[model samples]
Target chain A: GIQVEQSPPDLILQEGANSTLRCNFSDSVNNLQWFHQNPWGQLINLFYIPSGTKQNGRLSATTVATERYSLLYISSSQTTDSGVYFCAVAVYYGQNFVFGPGTRLSVLP
Target chain B: IAGITQAPTSQILAAGRRMTLRCTQDMRHNAMYWYRQDLGLGLRLIHYSNTAGTTGKGEVPDGYSVSRANTDDFPLTLASAVPSQTSVYFCASSGTASSGYTFGSGTRLTVV
Candidate 1:
């Protein structure tokens, strides 16, 4: 089983601020995705960067397979961005993905 | 128009009772999965089906059963509910085991 850990378990940022959330995995993974669980509890997929960089609007993600790590960047954070961000990974093309505890972000207006 | 849909956004049941959570996907994906998220914890996979007529156990499959009789539906059944089974359950589908998934809104189940 692959272990996934997210850093900065809890984060508080002011609106318009920028922050980076980190995810580290214990083994090589061929599939990785970042998800945002919004205030209403909808888990929205933000990125599917297995080993590269991807940008979607105000959020972006980068995964370095060799390093077994991934980063999620939020720029110009807004109140709407206040929620939990999770990173899930599948070990070397495995069928199941293991999710990290998540980084709880709170953007103050 | 193409996504996963889970029925009974939330549910409450008594211990020893049987319950089934419905999940349907219109994307016609080859892989479907069921995950349970406990309070203050991350989501843990309970069961997954690589394709129709085949199913596999996940990290936490005890007390849960899933059947994939067709391509569009994967229903999870609890033969006998327990309080420990109370959690938010999410259903997801992917084109394959190697791709990203689209998740349903989820079902919040509470067993008394």
Candidate 2:
């Protein structure tokens, strides 16, 4: 089983601010994804970056597989981005995925 | 299109009672998963099915059981509910083992 650790357990930002969150895994992984759990508790898929980098809207993520770490960037944050962001990973030969503790973000309008 | 729907958004059950959380997906995905979210600990896998008729235990499956009789349905059952089992449950489905998964809205259960 792999262990995923997320940094900055809690974060608060003003509207239009930017922030970055990091995730570190204990072992190699074949699949990695970033999810945003909205206030209503719906887990929205933000990125599926096993490696390299990807961007969508004001969010972007980078996974350095070799370093066993990943980063998620939120630029020009909005009130809508206020929620818990999670990073999950699935090992190459693992049957289940592991998730980090998550970073709770609050955006003040 | 009803990508995924979970039955009984919330439930309050007495300890030692039996309960089942139903999850169904219309996408006909081959892989289905069950996860539980607890305060501070993050989401932990309960069980998963690679396809119909095949099941596997996950990180925390001692008090939970799941079955995938068909491609579209995967239900998790708690044989004897306990207060420790109280948490938010989420069901997810994916087309393949290496693809993004679509998760249900989640089920909040309380065993008192």
Candidate 3:
């Protein structure tokens, strides 16, 4: 089994602040995804980057497979962005994904 | 298409009762997974089905059983519920292991 760890277990930022959350995996993976768990407990997909970079609105993600790490960037954050961000990975030749502990964010008004 | 639908958004059950969580996907994906989310611990896999008729245990499958009768359905059953079994359960489906998955809203369960 592979291990996934998230840095800055907790984060607090202002409404217009920018932040970066990091995820590190213990092994090489063929699949990696970032999700935001809202207050309602719905896991919202943010990005699916196995080994590249992608951006969606005020959010973006980059996965460096060789380095076994992924980063999520949030710019001009809003209060709605306050939630738990998780990074999950599926190791090569594995059928299941392991999730990181998550980074809890709080964006104040 | 409904990516995935989980019935009984929330449930409360007696410790010894049996309960089943229903999950269905309209995408015709070949792989489906069941996970339980707890505060601070993240989401832990309970079971997974790679295809129509095969199922496998995940990280936390002690009291959970799952069956894949068809492509669009994967139901998880608990033979006998326990208090520690309380958590938010999510059902997800993907075309394959390396692709992005679609997850249902989730079913929050509590046992007494």
Candidate 4:
């Protein structure tokens, strides 16, 4: 079984500030996704980066498969961004999708 | 209306009772999965199906069962609900094992 760990278990940022969240996995992954669970508990897909970098507006993610870690960047954060961000991964040809504990971000206005 | 749908947005059940959680996806994905999230913990896989007629256990499959009789629906059943089973359950699907995923809003279940 592969293990997943996320850093900065909790974070508090002022609106308009920038922050970075990191996720590290125990093994190589064939699938990886960044998800945001809003305060209302709706899961939103942020990105599906297996081995490269992707940007979605003010949010972006970079995954170094070789290093077995991924980084998510949130720039100009807003109050709406106050929620938990999760990183999920499926190791090489495995059907199991393991999720990290998540980075709880609170963007204060 | 086009993505995954989970029924009974939330439910409260008595211990030892049997209950089924419904999940349906219209994306025609080849793979579906069930995961449970506890308070302050990340989601843990309970079961998964690669395609229709095939299913496999996940990291936390004990006491939980899943069946994929067709392509659109994957229902999870609990033989006897327990207090520890009270958690948020999420249903997700992907075109394939290596493809992108879509998750349901989640079913918040509580056992008494």
Candidate 5:
């Protein structure tokens, strides 16, 4: 079983501010993903990065598989971004995906 | 296009009652999964099916059961619900295990 830990369990940011959320896993993973659980509880996929960097709109994510950690960057945050961001990982030999506690972000206007 | 749809957005059931959570996907994905999310706790996998007719237990499958009789539907059953089973259940599907999963809106189940 792999342990996934997310940093800054809770975050409050002013609209237009930038923030970085981190996820560290106990072991190497074959799959890593960042998801946003919206106010309606819909899990939307943000990024699927096992390694390397990717960007979509104001969001970007970087994963260092060697270091066993990943980072998600949200720039110019908006009020609609107020929700929980989760990181999930699937280890090499594991059939189940494990998720981090999540980073609860509250973007205040 | 209904990527994935879960039946009964919310449910209230008495303890010891049997309930089934239905999930269906129109994408024709080969894999489907069931997970439970608790407050402050991350989603925990309950069961998954690689394809039709093949199912496997996940992290928390003791109190739950699932069947995948066909590619489009995967249903989870709680034989005897308990208070501890109160949580939000999410159903997801993927083309492959390494790909990103498409999740449903989720079903909020409460056992009293």
Candidate 6:
């Protein structure tokens, strides 16, 4: 089983501030995804980056597969962004998708 | 278009009762997975099906069972529910492992 660890277990940011969340895995992964679990508990897909960098709106993610870690950047954060961000990875031909604990972000208005 | 539909948005069941959570996807993906989410613990996989007719256990599969009779439907069953089984269950599907997953709204289950 691959071990996944997410840094900055909890974060509090003022609206309009920028923050970076990190995820590190123990082994090579075939898939890496960033998800936002809103206050209502819906898992919203953010980015699917196996490797390389991708940007969606004010949010972007970069995964360095060789280093076995991924970074998620949130710029100009808003109150709506207050939620838990999770990083999940699928290793070994996607046999299983393991999830990290999560980075709980609270964007204060 | 409903990407994924989960029945009974929320449920409350007596301990030891049997319940089945229904999940249906219209995208016709080859892989389907069932996961349960708890406070502070994040999401934990319960079971997964690579394709129709094939099922495998996940991190927490005890007391939980899943069946994929076809590509569109994957139902999770609990033989005997317990208080600890109370959590929000999500169903997801993906065309391929690298393509990421589309998740259902989720079913919030409470066992008393």
Model 3: residues with Cα > 4 Å off, grouped in runs:
none
lDDT per residue (tens digit) for residues B18-43 in model 6: 99999999998999999999887888
Query: Which runs of model 6 end up more than 4 angstroms from their true locations?
Result: none
lDDT tens digits, residue span B1-112, model 3: 6689999899999999999999999998999999999876789999999899999999999999999999999999999999999999999998866668789999999999
Q: Give the CAPRI rating of model 6.
A: medium
The lowest-lDDT stretch of 10 consecutive residues in candidate 1 chain A is: A89-98
Q: Using DockQ as the measure, name the better of candidate 2 and candidate 4.
A: 4
Interface RMSD of 4: 1.5
Best prediction by DockQ: 6
Candidate 4: where is the Cα deviation over 4 Å?
none
- In order, the first chain's TM-score in every candidate is 0.97, 0.96, 0.97, 0.97, 0.96, 0.97
In model 1, which regions exceed 4 Å deviation? none
TM-score of 1: 0.97
Cα deviation at B62, candidate 4, in Å, is 1.4
lDDT at residue B96 of model 4 (Cα atoms) = 69
Q: Candidate 5, residues B1-112: lDDT per residue as tens digits?
A: 7699999999999999999999999999999999999986689999999889999988889999999999999999999999999999999998877777889999999999
TM-score for each prediction?
0.97, 0.96, 0.97, 0.96, 0.97, 0.97
The stretch of ten residues in a row with the least summed lDDT in candidate 5 chain B is B93-102
**Model 3 over residues A9-107: C-alpha lDDT tens digits?**
999999999999999999999999999988667899899899899999999999999999999999999999999999999986446888999999999
| lDDT measured at residue A20 in model 3 versus the true structure, 0 to 100 | 99
- Given the true complex, what DockQ would model 1 score? 0.74
lDDT of 5 by residue, A53-77 (tens): 9999999999999999999999999
